[model samples]
Target: MNDRLLALKLFSRAGRVGNFSSAGRELGLSQPSASRLIAALEADVGAALFSRTTRAVTLTDAGATYLMRVEAILAALDEADHEARGTGELRGVVRVGTPISFALREIIPRLPAFMKQHPALKIELRVTDRYPDLVTEGIDVSIQFGALPDSSATARKLIRQPRILTASPDYLRERGTPAMPSDLAHHVVIISPAHPSPTFSFRKDGRVVSVRVDGQLAITINEGAIASAVVGLGIAASSESSARAELEAGELVRVLPDWDVGSMEVTAVFVSGKTIKPAARAFTDFLATELRN
Candidate 1:
C-alpha cells in the first residue's frame, strides 16, 4: 500500500513537472523505473494518466482529478503518521511567531541547543513585530510582548522585560548625561511612536515624573530605536532583553539608572482549541524555561 502511495505521489510530481525523467530524478528513480511504475498505476486505475508528447507530458483530464485526490490522501497519511508518533518524543514542525528583535537577539542564538536536544523536531520561525492573528496565520505559538489585549488564546507569562532608557556612550559624552528625568527634555530623544504618548514616565521614592521629550529621530520600531541609539543617534528607550548585549559591551549606557520606564510582559500565547500540536507545546515550554533562566 505504501509503495502504491509513493508511486501515486511520484505520478503527481510528474504531472506538475510535466516530465518523467525530472520527476523520477526527484524521487530517486530512473526514467525507465518511473515509467514502469506509472504504467502499472494506469493499469490499476484503468485509465491513461498522461498524454505523451515530444516536448512535454501533459496530465489527462482524469489524471488531473486523480492528482488532486492523491495529494489529499498523501497529506492525510503524513498527518496521521505525525500524530501516531509519540508526543513526548517531540517530532513535527513548530511554527513560532516572535518579535524581530527578540527572535534575532535572543531566541535565534539559543535555538541550536534546543534543536540538538530534540533532533526529531523541526522549527519554523516567523519573525515580525506586529501582533499576529494566530489562527488566521496558522501560527503554532507566538511570543508576544507587553500587555496582551483580550484574546481567545491561552497566555503564559514567560518573562517581564524592563524598558531601559539608553544612549550610546559617545552621545552621552557629547550631549552630557541627564541628571534627572526632566533634563531628558533638553537632550535629543529618539521616541517610539508605538507608545501611546511621547512622554516617558518614571517613579522613585514616592515621586512620579513624566517628561515629554522630542527629537529629530523618531523610530517606529523597537529594534530600529535600539540600532539608532547604538549608532549614537540619540537617547532611546528599549527593552533590556533587546539592549543587553550592547549594555554589557559598554557600547550603550543607561541614561537614568535610578528611573524606571516600566516593564513589559513577554507572554507565550498558544491556540485556544484542543488541536494544539504536541511539538508546539513542547517548544513553547522549552522557550519559557530557557528564556527565564
Candidate 2:
C-alpha cells in the first residue's frame, strides 16, 4: 500500500477496466483517493494517464505504453510471490478480449469452473464484435473468430467449427427451401459483415463452389444474424456454437444439410509479446481446451 506501488496498481487496473472508480473499489480505495493517486502518478511521469469524459475514462497514448511495462513489472512480482510461497496458483489480472457471441454462448458459461481452479487470478473479459487493438486496449489476450490476416502478433488456432447456411422454419415454408446451392441466388440471404463480402463458398464431394448472394439486411454481429434468421429475416451463415440453441428449438433449420460453407476458425492472439505472464497463459490454455469440448 506504498504510494508508488499503489499508483502502479491503480493505473494498471484503471487502464484495464477503463474506470478509475471500479479499479479503486477493487483495491479497497475510495474514488477520491484513486483520482488523487492517478493525478500524482501522471504528474510524476510528466504525462496525462487518462483522457476523462463524463461517461468513461480511456487510456492516453502514453498511458497505454506505460501500462505495458507496468503490467510486466507487476506480473514479475506476482511470479516472485508465487515462487516464494511455493504454490503453483496464478495471481494478478489478465485482460482478455473475446467476440460477444462466443463469450456469451461458450466462454462465460464455462468460466466459473476455470475460476474455481485459479481463484487468485482475475479475468477481465472484454466482449465486442470489432477486432480490437490489443496493445492500445491493454488486452493480454484476444479470442477471435474468422481469419486473422495481421501477422504482427502471436496467434494460436483453438478450434475450427463448420459454418452452415440456416433459415427459420417460417422463412423456409414461405420462400421454399433451396434444392441446390445454386438455388440460393434466388432466395433472400442475410449478409454478415464478419464475412468479407456477400460472397459465400460451399464444398461438396471434393467440388468447391462459391456463390454471391444479396440480402436486404446486413449484420455485423454473428448473434444478430442468427437472431434475424430466427425471426424469418433470411438465410444466414452461422456457426454451430452461435446458433445451437435456436437450431435445437427448431427456430432455425439448415438450408442445405449436405453442403458445407467451409469453416470458421477461432484463434487466440497473445499481446504480451515473446514472454507471456503465467495467469494469461493459463487462461488461454483453459479457453483452448474448454472451447474444443
Candidate 3:
C-alpha cells in the first residue's frame, strides 16, 4: 500500500475507534497486520504514535497531536476527489464550538447569512460555558477566548477584547466609584469564573497598581455574576468587548477609566493541521474576514 494512504486509514481508524483491534477490523485486516502497518508508518514518520498494551491501545501525546493533521489530509483528499467527480457544490456538516456569550452575542445572529451563502452545508453549533475537546467532540471549528496554554492545535486571533472593570449604576450610586485601583478594597468586588487566586491591575497617574480583590460571591465563567453586578450586587470584571453592548445600553458602567489593564486575545481555532476539513477552513476564513471588518 502507498504509505500515505496506509497511514491515513490506520490513523483514521485508530482515532475513531480508540482501539487497535476495532481499527484493524474496519480495514479488513488482522490485528497483527494492522499493527505491522502502523509500526511501519510510525517508522517512516519517526514518531511513536500509540502506547500499546495487551488490554488496550491509547494515543500517545504525539499520536493525539498527529491524529488531527492526518484527518485533515484525508479530508482534503476526499474533497478533491469529490470535486473532480463533479460534486456541484461544497456540501458537508461543519461543527462549530463557541463560548456561550460570543455564541449568543455574535456568531448565532450571523450564522443565517453563512447558511444562505452555502445552502448545501449543514451547520452544527455547540454553545457552552465549558470548553470541549475539539477532537473528542468532533468539532470542526471553535471560537475561543483568552490565551490558552500550549497546545499543538493552530489558533488565529479573531479580535482583541479588553478586560474592563465595571459595576451597576445602582451599585456605583450607593457604594461610590473607586477613583483608583487601591480604592477597590472598600467595594464589594464580584468575582466570577473564580480564579485559583484573584489578582487584578489598574493604573494610578500612569503607574500600574496591582490589587488582589476578594468577594463574597464566586461564580463560574459567563454566568450570572455580571447580571448580579448589573442588578447592584457588586463590582465585576469581564472582557470589555463582551460587556460593550451592555455598557452602551446603560446596564453597566465602566469604572477606573485611567487604568491600563490589558486585554486578552480572542481567537478562532480549528483542528486543521491534522484534520483540515474544507468546511472548517471555509468557516474560519469567513469568521476572520467578518470580524476584521
The better candidate by lDDT, 2 or 3, is: 2
**Prediction 3 TM-score vs. true:** 0.74
Candidates by lDDT, descending order: 2, 1, 3
lDDT of each: 0.81, 0.85, 0.75
Residue-wise C-alpha lDDT for candidate 2, range 196-291, written one tens digit per residue: 477878888998888878777899888889889999999988777888889899999888889978788888898635356677778889988887
Task: TM-score each candidate.
Answer: 0.70, 0.79, 0.74
lDDT tens string, model 3, 61-99? Answer: 888778777776778786795477575355767889987
Q: Predict model 1's lDDT versus the native.
A: 0.81
Worst 10 residues of 2 by lDDT: 271-280
Query: Which candidate, 2 or 3, would have the higher TM-score against the true structure?
Result: 2
Residue 115 error, candidate 1, Å: 0.9
For candidate 1, lDDT tens digit of each residue in 72-137? 676566567666774546665678999888899989999998898789887888888888877545
The C-alpha RMSD in Å for every predicted model, in order, reads 8.1, 4.2, 6.0
